[model samples]
Target: MAECDAEWELCKENIQPLRQGRSVSALHQALCQQQEGNHTALNQQKQSVHQTSRLYFTFESELRLYDGDDPLDVWVRCGLLG
Candidate 1:
């Protein structure tokens, strides 16, 4: 588990927390980005978050399709359950 520990050490500051935990590939990619000066990824992340935040705010009030369940499950009610 030294490799895992090393990877975590290399990218600990850049890793974002998630409910399912960090992906190994994502951790490696972050390490590579850090080795490559890290500015590009930081800026891109900032812009992406800003755009997503704006989109969320703009469409959050209008999004009424979901009823707190998976919409695709409704296909079963339309005779597709067979």
Candidate 2:
């Protein structure tokens, strides 16, 4: 686990920060998958997931509606749901 953490720290050095920080566990899993010698298949799977995520975010942004009257309404709705 310490070795994985060290390796992930090194790997993260070259990556640009996103709005949300990257996951350490995800990085460790990716490293393990990389060592399994299925680069092409793994790359394709990663690409597919990234593409789908991008599409979902794009659509969500485009379709989002805001009444602009009360931003706190969302929190109220969430609190009600919870």
* Model number with the top lDDT: 2
lDDT per residue as tens, model 2, 1-82: 9999998888775667788888999999999888876878888899999988886676555446646677655545534323
TM-score, prediction 2: 0.34
In order of appearance, the predictions have TM-scores of 0.32, 0.34
Residue 45 local lDDT, model 2: 97
lDDT of 1 by residue, 1-82 (tens): 9999998898768646789987899889989878777787788999999988876655553344547566555444433344
Among the numbered candidates, top TM-score falls to: 2
Q: What lDDT score is found at residue 22 in candidate 1? A: 75
